[model samples]
Target: MKSLWLSQAGLDTLDNTVALCPNCHRKMHSLNLEEDIIKLRDKVKNYNYK
Candidate 1:
């Protein structure tokens, strides 16, 4: 959700958010994965738009 704009499209609802362990969450954020977020955001937006 925070990684991408999933929150803006209601895609960040509980049904969609994943449960991550603390370590994993930290690792993911530490990577600064903007490209991944952008790609995922676009993919989900496309899927939802259809």
Candidate 2:
């Protein structure tokens, strides 16, 4: 099985470590999550789930 580690924006581990999804074996360097909450709300209004 693989494992993952996340280094928080700090110096030490006991107070600055973040645990990520263990299956991913590497540290997450960066994330590019766009805040599309408004777009999603509008899209869901017109989307048919069936």
Candidate 3:
């Protein structure tokens, strides 16, 4: 699995509750908004590294 990070669209929806990597945030803007949400959900569910 790949390391998961927050996207720009995700950050927008988060309403300033989270920090984002600049490059990831920029790339996220190029992706479909809906797809970003879906990817975020999947990333959360699979977030078990801790």
Candidate 4:
């Protein structure tokens, strides 16, 4: 899972969490990619109005 603790987005909230595959999760941390962080934040927001 991609942890939101150090994320630029909100923490400990339904709209700030998501499950990610192992490889994808590892790559995100290793790369420290800002784009990936943005994507993850956007992905979590999908739950906002649901």
TM-scores of all candidate predictions against the true structure = 0.38, 0.25, 0.37, 0.57
Candidate 1 regions with alpha-carbon error over 4 angstroms: 1-12, 15-30, 48-50
Pick out the ten consecutive residues of candidate 1 with the lowest summed lDDT: 1-10
> Model 2: residues >4 Å from true position, as ranges?
1-35
lDDT per residue as tens, model 3, 1-50: 43333442333344233344886666665664777757766776686756
Q: What digit string (tens of lDDT, one per residue) describes model 4 on residues 2-24? A: 55553665477854556889998
Clashing pairs in 1: none
Q: Write the per-residue lDDT of candidate 2 for residues 1-50, one digit (tens) a residue.
A: 21223333345554334334653223234432234333434565686758
> Over the stretch 1-50, how does candidate 1's per-residue lDDT look in tens digits?
34433434646565466455887556556774878556655666676523
**C-alpha local distance difference test of each model:** 0.57, 0.39, 0.55, 0.72
Best by TM-score: 4
Error of 1 at 41 (Å): 0.2
Give the lDDT of residue 43 in candidate 1.
66
Q: Model 2 lDDT vs. the true structure?
A: 0.39
Total clashing pairs in model 2: 0
Q: Which model is ahead, 1 or 2, in terms of lDDT?
A: 1
